[model samples]
Target: MSSRPEAAELGFGDIEVGQVYEIERSFSATDVQAFAAVSGDHSPLHVDPAYAAGTEFGSCVVHGILLASLFSQLVGMRVPGRHALYLGQDLTFRRPVLVGESVRAIAKVTAKSEATSTVVLNTEIRSSDDKVIVMGTAKVKVRDQVRESVAAASAASAVPAGAARSVALVTGASRGMGAEIARTLARRGHAVAVNYLRSADKAEQVVQEIVAAGGVAMAFQADVRDAEAVRAMTQQIVERLGPPTVLVNSAVGEFANRPIAELRWSDFEDHLEYQLKAVLNTCQSVHPLMKAAGAGAIVNMLSQVVGGVPPNGLADYVSAKTALLGLSKAMAAEWAEDGVRVNMVSPGLTRTEMTQHYHERVFKMEAARTPLKRIATTADVANSVSYLAGDDSAFMTGVNVFVTGGQTMI
Candidate 1:
């Protein structure tokens, strides 16, 4: 078995359609004989070599049931995991499997029944050559259990909070994913400095919420586009939160869906100022503090469109993000020796207030196209940032983590 740890037991609430899990196994002739002895299917085609040699198969074949058994492992050991109980399964054998042939069994969730607490999975068994060996469907009901999404996500990467110096600075944290990143870092025991441009009230609200949750936080207002203002804000954060060892660059300009013909150079310039320039200012402001600490993390928020196909009207947004992405990689390369790691989180079409301009059909189309059958959530992006901002990713630098729910696989 792979050394990867098991996932948390999933309840109906935690399961999403189009989610997938798989396992592999190679059947041995000894295993076939054992099944033959147990099930009493001693047919020559399956057990007798000479009797089968004259037949179309030319050799003994493993029982279809032995291959289908992997689906049970898929349901019982993964996805919904230990909490799942089989409701039913329908199978269609597509090809024969000879002994010692390796096959991978895959299960993908197709539907969820809220009323019945059941999940339907499209199941398949494929040969090592990528040929479909068997195809089937399974219906499983998950046992009720509490969902611990945050805990499970952090289990792999989180360090002991009290033992680590965790001070976080999240820019544009007055609302949206930024606010959530601030809150999440605080929850992970970081003293959060919430940076905002104009929404002091919203920034203060985020700070108060963190305080109420038994976490340390403070709000700082600064125009990240101004290098001097960013440096000043860093001084304030240092005085209060002990200098930010974790910096999240999320201060971005307002997006507009305008075509090239309808746009001005200022439009693209505005995005570059908000994205590339603001990030540069913040990174410089926090670099000295992080270098002094001997270890630091920078989580740059970027968009998936920069790496994939861009929509017609989003050239400005895409261009800005592209520049930011390149800058982040360069920083990661140059700053590694200084103990400051730079990484990026690029999320797909997330349903946030900024994206309210997207039409319902467009939203649905994106979700349907995604492998997970849904758009990225703020929590999804926030969790990725948290992982990159922590000790779990200590050895990682210059990597881009995609929070796109498999929309843009790169």
Candidate 2:
């Protein structure tokens, strides 16, 4: 396994779904004997090589429970790190692990419940041959010590008094996918500016949650389509947090879905203002800050509807999104010289409050059609945005990341 990050570097807030941690060790005869001595399960198959060979033409096997214990090490020492209390585990021994064979145990966060401060991890142990030997799930409760450690780490890692940590401005972040993006960025150590047009209460709630999670964040209101409003909002963020080195243009205005024949030009114009003009306003406002920093990332949120035509009534929405894709590529090319990168994230029908009114059958059909057999969630989209916002994609620009579960492939 790779070297573990410092215990102070991790907390429940830092845990992300699909994050993996692993550790490996080779068990020896002495280890097996020690286990046998401790548990008193001195079966011949485990302690006596000759008797084991007679029965199964094999050598001594390590105790299944002994191998399973590695999971405790993984969850308690790594991953959540230092403050994980082993709640319970369910194990299934898939194959026998021979003594003297190296085994690697992996723990992956599958789900996290912030309200309860618990995380569910998928655990598996594999032999050196890369064959699974044991598989299971673990439940753990994270303690307040981890939270305190995270707060201390955040403060310790903050830039000097005059300098600032990289700030990320997320528009329309009061709810849905935008809210998740704000939280995720904060967790990743970015000071976040959560922008909302009207959801003041919800926006404050997001900021409070980030603060509670030991991250830095503040809330601001702005109509992203208005150049003056965006300028004012950006200045406010700079004064309160820092110049935004990352910008996520997720602000959206309401528009009706209507067929081209039924739609007026005003409908198309409304979407254009929402999708294209809003992106333009935020990008232009942050360009100077990014250029000064010699680096920046901009992620534009688009819709999967642009991939193909719907059955009816989405021409205006789809057209504006498609245009935004083109505009993003143009901006990428224009800003390459200034050390700014532009990208787009197109998400399929995600189950946000905005889409809750979607018919049940529509969701089921989309799920069945998707290769992953599931619809996208807000976290799923936020994960993609987080990836593009960080250094993980430093070499990438002008790319469209589809969070569609393979529903739309190009």
Q: Flag regions of model 2 displaced more than 4 Å.
A: 1-164
> Per-residue CA lDDT of candidate 2, range 1-410, in tens?
87855553357778876689999997898999999999999999999988988766388888988998899778767867677777777777988888888999998875554324556677899888888889876777777675656544554554333223778999999998899999999888888999999999999999999888878888999999899899788867765565688999888877665677899888999989989998999998888667645689999999888777654688888888999999999999998987899999999989987888888999999999999999999999998999999999999999999999998889
- Write one digit per residue (lDDT tens) for candidate 1, span 1-410: 79966755877777875588889899887888888899998877778778878878877788989788899888988868878888777677988998778899999875553323556677899999899989866767777644334333442233233423467999999999899999999888798889999999999999899878877788999999999898778766654445578999998888788989998989999999988999999998777556645679999999888776787998888999999999999999999987899999999988877988878998899999999999988999999999999989999999999888887775
Q: Can you tell me which runs of candidate 1 are displaced by over 4 Å?
A: 1-165
What TM-score, to 2 decimals, does candidate 2 have? 0.61
Top-lDDT structure, candidate number:
2
Which pairs clash (backbone N, Cα, C closer than 3 Å) in model 2? Answer: none
Q: After superposition, how far is residue 325 of candidate 1 from its true place, in Å?
A: 0.9
Q: How far is 142's C-alpha from truth in model 1 (Å)?
A: 58
lDDT of 1 at 344: 96
